[model samples]
Target: MFCLVLHSHLPWLANHGRWPVGEEWLYQSWAATYLPVTAVLRRLAAEGRTRLLTLGVTPVLAAQLDDPHCLNGMHHWLGNWQLRAHEAAGMPSASHRDLGAREHRASAAALDVFETRWRHGGSAVLRELIDAETIELLGGPLAHPFQPLLDPRLRAFSLSEGLADAEARWGHTPAGIWAPECGYTPGMEIGYAAAGVSHFMVDGPALRGDTTAGRPVWDSDVVAFGRDLEVSYRVWSPKTGYPGHAAYRDFHTYDHDTGLKPARVTGRTVPSEKKAPYDPELAAVAVDQHVADFVDTVRRRLRSESERIGGPALVVAAFDTELFGHWWHEGPQWLEQVLRALPEAGIEIGTLADARARGYVGAPVELQDSSWGSGKDWRVWAGDQVQDLVQLNAEVVQTALDTIDKDRDANHHGFEGDPELRKRVHDQMLRETLLTVSSDWAFMVSKDSAAGYARDRAHKHAHALREIADAVASGRDEVARRLADGWNAADGLFPALDARRLPVRSAETAAFAGSTQ
Candidate 1:
């Protein structure tokens, strides 16, 4: 049996009143992926196929999915997609008119049911699938931290809070976590063990202590599964993934005339206007071919391994869930069909937990700090453009420590009723802190995708923390109130952040290492 792990996650883009980056990203992903993916699973269940695959949906993403504001936004976005598709279908006889009609109708129907089930509280359709055992849901830390780069206490608090939130909503605590970006560092196993995580997924290289994929590896207490890069990469190979094939819709090129996304991925280097129209028949053929190639690859790898190890070998294929409906367009359909085809051809599909149950453990070893970014280094977060934010983070982190040390002791009057609020503050601080620390920001800066926006957000969060520290320092209620109000205005996602419970450190840790405060 091959274990297929789909990690679905995004940061908390809530009703924090932020835009162009935060909550909008959540709604966009929801419309493009979440609702569609769930619908796909529901259809599979109806076909009598017992859907038992592992999925890691981060708490931050789940929280937004369940948020009243986000629910409303997604409902609106889905409707807009339906209308847009409808409008596109009416345009002049473009090559993609038929495809547009089918897509528009399907999207409208799906949204109609999704809105009906998402009753302002819980996503009933998703709940139904979970109850039916079609999908195995997993949860990860709040804000999806690059764990290996996080402070020890911060890591514990984030994982603990995330797990608790999962238990509250999903009715079961996840036994495994998908480290954000598979960012693994030495000693992270201790954190996973503390969080009660029995297993976590890492890249193939992280397991072998090298990029070569010859064997599976494990830590002292946690089991690590590597993505079967050969099979997994086939669907989205570096250059010639299914998305870049000639028959499928081009993700990058959009038609400005009708506001419809109508370009096809002609061969590499072909301009958008020169490409052919998206032909569903041709795409179906491509999906079929890719599916066959993927199945054969998995079968060969597993059989070869079984021959060597004298047992039933497992290949774990992992991917970002969003890559399905959003990036690849026809990705969700391709996945559903591929899932069925693979099993029919003798390739068994299993979850991470299933692989572990079959005694697929590896030799114990420590992992190095890393991410799935370019060069797989820490430069993404700690790079030059984001240096100011890093310095600001250190400063505010120190200020938070000093506040805790000086005012928040056994006799602290503000710690009692404020724990939840304190927790909110701590969590939000951690969130912004993590966001500011995200390797993506640096990568984006390097790639030049609104670097100013990323930099501003990073520093803004740091500034908010400084204000919080100042309020605590003066014992002036008005100052704290104003700063809290400002944060509330800027970020309404976490209203319960108690300014009092923010962690405090000793004078030494509070003091700057090389720079003066």
Candidate 2:
């Protein structure tokens, strides 16, 4: 069996900012990736394709998608896209004008889809796919924090709350998670088992023992599926990948006049101005060839692994969901073609959940700490490049927990304080703390992709957390309330979050000691 997993995630950006980053990032991904990808899934579902694949949509991204503010913003952004296309049509270059016309039509279609289907929010759209059993939805923590670096109490709290949020939206709790960056520590399986997570993903090196099949972790029944890099990298990588094909639209090169891509990749080292004009027809041909090649690769790998294991084997290929239409313009069409072609080629396709139920299990193994980042270690997040951000996160988490504990204690004393007011303050503190710990800012800074922007975002959240904590501690109830309300209105993503669920370290420590048997 072949299980394809796509991890879809973006940090909480709604009401934070927009433009070259922020909510614009969400809108571009929605119009270019989410809408098109889901359209493909819906078509397959209409033809009764069950267990198509496994998709992980993080709680933070889910909250933003479902937010009315984001929905309205996305609607406006699509209109802007249409307007840009119209402006492009009058460009002096014929190719540029054609590109604009094509984009204009695409924007129109997306606008229609959003107004008719997605106007309700992303949950409504995803829920339809889940209800149809077209895809197995995987949930992750409220924010995509690097779980291994988090305090154990926070880890448990985040996972539990995240799964609960998924259930509230989709009516089913995910049995698996695409762990943030596939980051794992040795003892995480205990937490997974406790949270009712039956399976999760990891980098191939984490299994050190074998990468052919899902291995039961340590002594827990929870299974760990390792991504097959050999297969996944064929579609996307830093060096060679299908999107870099000379015939495909150049992702980096955009026309200055209309801000639309009008050239093909042309050559690996070719300058933007010298690149050949994009021919969608040529790109279509490349897509067909790549689809056939991918199917054959999967077939060959599955056959070889099955023989080696003395039985049928499973090959899991995973990738970031945004890589599809967002990065590679023709990626959605290629994906739809691949999904349709694989079944007819006698290759069985199913979700990770389906693969597990079919008994694709191996002996238990102790996995090493790992992630899918550079060196397959924690360097991308905990490395020297971003040590300052790491320190900020540590301080923010501790301060938020301290404030929550202080409020809990005051409530226990039956103080004259309004319970509702205290809860709001605690909730806002937790929100800012989670935003501060998001793995995105550290990653962006470490990669140097948007270091300044990333650093500013991380500090912004941390500052909010500190101010709320200080206000609460200083007995300035009115000041604290105002700060909490303002931040809540700006950065709030998870409306279902209950700050009371966060674990108090002192109580959790005693509970851990009691459960050691």
Which of the numbered candidates is closest to the native, going by highest TM-score? 2
- With candidate 2 superimposed using the best TM-score fit, by how many Å does residue 497's alpha carbon deviate from the native? 0.7
| TM-score of model 1 (CA atoms) | 0.87
> Which candidate has the top score in lDDT?
2
CA error at residue 98 for candidate 1, angstroms: 4.2
lDDT of 1 at 370: 61
Deviation from native of the Cα of residue 434 in model 1, angstroms = 4.5
Model 1: residues with Cα > 4 Å off, grouped in runs: 14-24, 92-100, 119-125, 209-219, 383-386, 410-435, 438-440, 494-517
Q: What is the lDDT of residue 194 in candidate 1?
A: 72
> In model 1, which range of ten residues has the least summed lDDT?
209-218
lDDT (tens digit, per residue) of candidate 2 on 131-219? 99999999999899998887777788889999999999888899999899999988899999999999999987788725678999999
Error of 2 at 464 (Å): 0.8
